[model samples]
Target chain A: MKCPLCGLEFNQEDGLKGCSGCKSMGACGLIKCPNCGYEVPAESGIVKFIKRWRKKTDESK
Target chain B: MTVNLSRKRPQCHSTADMEIDARRSVVLVGSPNVGKSVVFGNLTGMYVTVSNYPGTTVEITRGRLADDSRAVAITDTPGMYSLLSITEEERVARRVLMENRPDMVVHVADTKNIERMLHLTVQLLEAGMPLVLDLNLMDEAERLGMRVDTKVLKERLGIPVVATVATKGMGMDELKKMILKEDILPSGPPLRYPETIENAIADIAKNLDSSYGISKRAVALLLLQDDHEIWQMVRDREPERYALVDAIVKHARERFADPLNYIITIERQRFINTLIEDAMDNDQVKGIPFRERLSRLSMHPVAGVPIFLGIIYLLYEFVGVFGAQTAVDFLEETVFGQYINPVANRIVSSIIPWKVLQDLFVNEYGIITLGIRYAIAIILPIVTTFFIAFSIIEDTGYLPRLAMLIDRVFKKIGLNGRAVIPVVLGFGCDTMATMVTRTLETRRERVIATLLLALAIPCSAQMGVILALLSGSTKALGIFVMVMGTVFLFVGFLAARLMPGERPLFYMEVPPLRWPKLSNVLTKTYTRVEWYFKEVLPLFILASILIWAGRITGLFDLVIKVLSYPTGWIGLPPEASKAFLYGFFRRDFGAAGLYDLKTSGALSGVPLVVSIITIALFMPCIAQFSMTIKERGWKMAVGMAAFIFPFAFVVGYLVNLILNGLGVVL
Candidate 1:
């Protein structure tokens, strides 16, 4: 995911670590961009599945 | 994926054979988010999960290149800015390069940010590693009308430069070829420094006969910069010459007013400027794109306020009207109230028989009835909608511009524009925002920010309910904004005056604005909802148990009776005291309670507006209170809570008195 603030593309896990390190309550479920400290929400499994489905459909077309 | 380095090493090999057949490692290093991972993926064709680097929690990714010619170990180090490490991650990146002693060092850099990233490139060169300069993200650079003359840059730096759009598999074959070759690029000369510093380097280098994985020149520079780790390494290696090295560094420091790191950086920047003059071209024209124009308009002081207000208005519409009134009501009334609660109550009453156990499960403040219901019915939809709106704001890259727009005002409150990050975040969760205050530079700034967040900022859950409560009365909403806005500014101004410290400097990288992707927005909302539920469900259950305990012990009533005095003082009815008491647990819980009161016609006009202002300005929820204590220490957190609790009622009372005295009615 691209960090909105710094525009650095990082894996979602790196963002989650950044969020956890900040001692957030985990309620926001945001991944902090390790590069610029901007918070981004992680993609859900359902959302990920939908995205993959959409891409597969697009490819089929 | 695998954070353990020990687990990652190939096992069951003889030491001799291991030394002979060990793949030549190609280590990738760069500042964070430069697509180093993408490049690594392209080269390796394998999955490498991020894990803590050994004992330290810093994440590092290691993979192996799939090549017919030979096995190549490809390790992607954590992002780092410079070799003179300040952060733990930077130290880890340097450690990977130093300890691995890789055959090739691929310095990946974002093409658009070459000027800033070149400083790291110079540091890498100084380390005397065989370097390949991978100028990644060429697509983004061209889109911004930036063109880098790769031939000129390579010629100037004396390294093989490869331009790539890593995401699209551009330039990977050449990158792989360069990595596989033994003698791809010559070891370049170390970055030139001022004559005085160069003399010091030479003096220090003369005594260093031992090989450090990196060049002696780099070690000498590290020594000059007072890098503690390098100094220790030198002390352990060359105890006899360590004193001499220290004396040289001390002498060099004495000669310059500024630190050696700053001096070195300035020199590197000067060299980069010279390199850029011949290599980089910018065809920036007056015909800016619509997105760029919108970006500028967002940061314009005059126009930005309306834009900011418009965003807030939209937030109120979505989370307040749509989520709170529409979704929350349906979930609360039809779903939970009609079906879930009644069925659960019957089961608990029939099976359990004991009133205490039954109440714990299905009564008014029962864990299952109230806690789960509030988490699912009241807060979830509201928070989800808020996250969707917030994701749009974030993905569009409007946040940094908002920071720039409010920087001038933030400075007056002893904070720079950077404080906008935590402040904007406070809207989502004050607990998280309190923790984020550590990102601020000074203790004074963190304390001031903490105080403001506790006293004024309402979390999304609370904001949703407050917006819903006030949506019916324009005058009430207007007065609520006026009252809370006044307290926010007034306290901030006083806090700034009271705190003594150097003013923080403001600097932020503003990303270009673009349309938010729907997939991203939906995913963000879903993740945030999941996270919100995971965090709040337990807290809500615990709060219910605690409230149950308090009710049984008679403490709850006593507290409410004590709270009712202040509630009445703020012009709210005695029934509103329950909500204020609940506010101590979670700000949203109290606001939701107030929503119940307002809908039942228990509050109206000036009293309703006063209740909204008071709850909005109330002390932060219990979680934020504890977080403040953890981040800022007991005295500060307790002091802030002490101030905020009474201050909320005082401000609410003042607003009520003023409105009632003026005969203003909503």
Candidate 2:
């Protein structure tokens, strides 16, 4: 995912900066948009999975 | 407006995090994996996986749906039971209702389980959320001999209800039309309880001057039952108004035969019964009865704990001993150690002129040598096996039953059954499990669970190595179990005594057990492995780089010197301190580090046992530390750290003292 601030993609969950900032902030549970220091929530995995599933199905069709 | 700390997570927070400002969006909300997401893809014209089952998505997703100027934004929400939140997913769903102020909500229910599903719809209606009810899986419902009366149900619900077979594109146009033309303004009739209760609610509402998004009556009912967030919200809105409201609730309790909340709930059920009478053809038969009976047995006290232990042993045998020991040896020793490492070392020695650059790639402790090797050869294979096993277990619907089974024992230890999720997840990886503690009902429960996880329960990586290390000696395994049990009980007892607030009750829905679908398990395992590999690799490399930097700067030796004193006090070798320190980096890495010590013959029986105990009870892995700070905040996280670091060694020292005093030889 592209970091909003840096426009760089880190092929990982949470922040791309190895969660250095969040570790300091003490909130590694939140998803850090890998590009910009944006912290999003980590909610239910199934819902997000299905959302992705829907997207894939649509694209294939 | 209150600043919701948990809000604004795009990736893990909310599906709509990125798309909130759009003119319109489709919010794909439903039960776990009912193809709401597949339907979302069809609507948005985007690429997303269409999997059978995997309950991993914890956040919202956004996409745009368009068909010739009928453009709308789409959001996929986590599965939730009701508007009255219990789980974090439920809280997120409720927050979406208030914050986004959606023009319409797609209440996707599995058409087969309409009885249980419609309870949430009634709550959404009661909360006055604008909704278009989509009965997804109409085909599956029909195949199961279930027929829903859509038109009558819509009339009864006072909203447009659309029948959708989402995977096949059934009823798309009707659903779209309902979303467009159905009244955005909710017309749900104000549900009335008996006159006695109605009179009480009217009194409560009249006194409650604070205007809420939900009706005051609903808020009043919630407040009496000690809904913390709702109580705080009302307190913030009208600081002086609580006394009178409290009096009203007390008065209602005196008059009511049952707890007012229970009474209100029963009334709501009766209301749902009448609605179903108009809208549903209730099916009395289900195919999964034997499965249901077995599922129930797994949770019963006599059978459940043994079943739980049996499952744990199977997991230990399959994932820990077998996977981490045998499979890992093959991958790490035979494949990577023999072929890859030698080849890479030769290539690096030949190519690099600078000694330091070569050191970074393939030296005694090179990033490529240790980091890449551990991540790929060791952690990769072990976690792959774990994910496959976990996926299979989850697919068979056994985990929830396991939770129910454990809830009884958990209660004795000052936790309820719901604590089972995070505790169980701790076995997978404590970092994610610590984050999952947000699903707990109260702060005290979260704190207690977090502490237990940090102190006693081994994350899967750590479990893998420790299980492997102890595999040779059955006595060693027994001692390990005994030490772990002692720590769990001692810490749990102290925490129960110290933490304030009453223990929250747990109620879980146990889905039926079945033979795990292979295709479903495979997909889930693959996705998890993808997610896991993404998490581990960089951290491993970074850990190596940091250790290298520490070495270059003399910080590593300085800290090792500091740790060695504690190491000696705990009756462990000085080198064991290095392993303990690195254990903070990643769990398995630390264990692997200890393997180096063991191979060097620096640690033997007593010290080895002490070291294992100490590491097991040491501070949480780095990821968990990060999550603890995130979920519980820094003061508590640091305080937990402050207690853990000193306390772990203290326990180790004490264990050594006891063992030595008893003259025990393993």
Candidate 3:
């Protein structure tokens, strides 16, 4: 995912694996950008799979 | 895309062997938001995880690269501006450099920001790391008619420099080749400082026996700049020379009118400018593009207000009407009410003979009936819609412009444009926004932003519900907006006055506004929704259970009776007390309670407006309260809550009193 604030591209996983000191690490579910501390939502696995599948089909067309 | 060096033992950040790897291990380091991760992904495919850099909770990504005989470990560090660290992230990045003596240090920089970004590159060179500078994001830079001479830059710095469009895999082959060639990986001479500073550094470096994995000159420079970590390291490792080191640093500081750190930064900037002068060329046309003009208009004080208001209205229509009314009604009344709830109620009742256990699962506030319903049916659609809209705004690069537009207002509250990030974010979720307040430079700014967020900014869920409640009555909605706006400004001004700190200077790079790509928007929205569900679902269930327990013990009824006094004081009926109590758990749920009242013809006109205003201004939900405590500590969080609870009602009462006095009916 691209951080909108700083325009840095990072893996969604790196974003979700936020600072460990945060009390709501497991539950808050926000992905903190490693560069700037901007928080974005964590994308689900199913959505990612579907999007990839759709893109593949679209390219085939 | 893989480059392999000689086989040797891996050097992790935790290890202190001070053994430089004979085999090639690559470490990527740069300022944050410079596309280091993209470069890392291209270099090492699919072998990455969050590895803590020893004692700190900060995570740096460590990945493995493979070839025919040996595997090299590649570590991607957190963003750091210089060797002198200001943030924990910077400290971790510096530690990774000191502890892991990687064969090649890939300093990734955004090509668009070559001037500002070159300082870190100079710092890395001074540290005596074997450096390969990758100027990433050349595509964006070229689009702006800016050209960088990679050959000139290489000659000027005496290091291997590669220009790359990392996103499109441009210049990857050259970068890979540079990383693999051992002969090309030469240690450049450190940046020479002014003569006086050079003499002081030389005096200090003469006494230092160890560089501790970095150059002795770098250590000497850090000591002169009063780097605490270096001071501590010196105290622990070379106590005999610590006093001498301290005196040299003190003498250096006394010699300068400005702090030595600032002096050093200025010197570095001067050096960087000389380098940039030879390396970069600009041929930008006199006339700006239409997109650039639009970007300017979006930040113009007069023009930007209407655009901002338009965006807000669009947000209401999308998140409120389409999401809250259309999607929520279908999910709530049709899906859950007509199908799921009845089925779940029947199943729980048939299985459990005891009324208590059945009630816990199937009753009005049951885990499944209320909690799951609220999470999916009410909150999900609203948050999803808001996230999608927000992601589009972010991806289009309008946020920085918005920050510029509102910076004047923010200044009145002792905050600069940077505070706009958290304020805009508070609409998504105040809990997360509270956490983001950590990004602010000053304690005073963070505190004021925190107080304003808690007092006036409504989270998406709460905003969605309130918008749904009052959208039918335009007059009521207007009043609600006016009251919240007034309170936001007034409280922010007071807090700014009460707090103490210098107003920070505001400077931010505003990226060119572009059309938002569908893939990016969808991906971001999906990520946010997934995160939102992971956070809100369990909390909603716990809230249901707590409410059920409170009901079973009759505490719920007692609290409702007591709250009715304040409800009446705000000119709302006794029936409104239940909604107010539900609000303590979740703001949206409480607003949803009022929605039920309005539909059933219980709340309307002046009282309805008062109820919505008070609930919007009420203390944030439990998650936000805990986050406030985490970020601002217990005293500030508790104090904020204590002040806000009464203040919400007082404002509500005053609004009600004024409206009734005018004989106004909406």
Of models 1 and 3, which has the larger TM-score? 1
Per-candidate chain B TM: 0.75, 0.64, 0.71
Clashes of each: 3, 42, 4
Candidate 3 lDDT over residue span B83-198, tens digit each:
88755778788888888787889999988778778888888888888898999999987786677889998888888889998889999877766666544454655477777788
State the lDDT of candidate 1 residue by residue for B129-240, as single tens digits. Answer: 8888999999988887677899998877888899999999999999988777656444666467989999999999998878788888999999988798999999999989
Per-residue lDDT tens digits for candidate 1, residues A1-61, read 6667666655666666655544444446577766457565566777778879999999999
Q: Using alpha carbons, what is the TM-score of model 1?
A: 0.74
C-alpha RMSD (angstroms) for model 2: 11.2
RMSD of each: 6.9, 11.2, 7.5
Model 3 interface RMSD, one decimal: 3.9
- Misplaced by over 4 Å in model 2 are A1-61, B1-200, B203-290, B350-357, B416-421, B436-443, B473-475, B598-609, B630-634, B654-666
Please tell me which predicted candidate would have the highest TM-score against the true structure: 1
- Candidate 3 stretches with Cα past 4 Å from truth are A8-18, A24-28, A48-61, B1-110, B121-142, B145-209, B212-286, B296-303, B341-364, B400-408, B416-425, B436-443, B473-479, B507-512, B630-633, B658-666
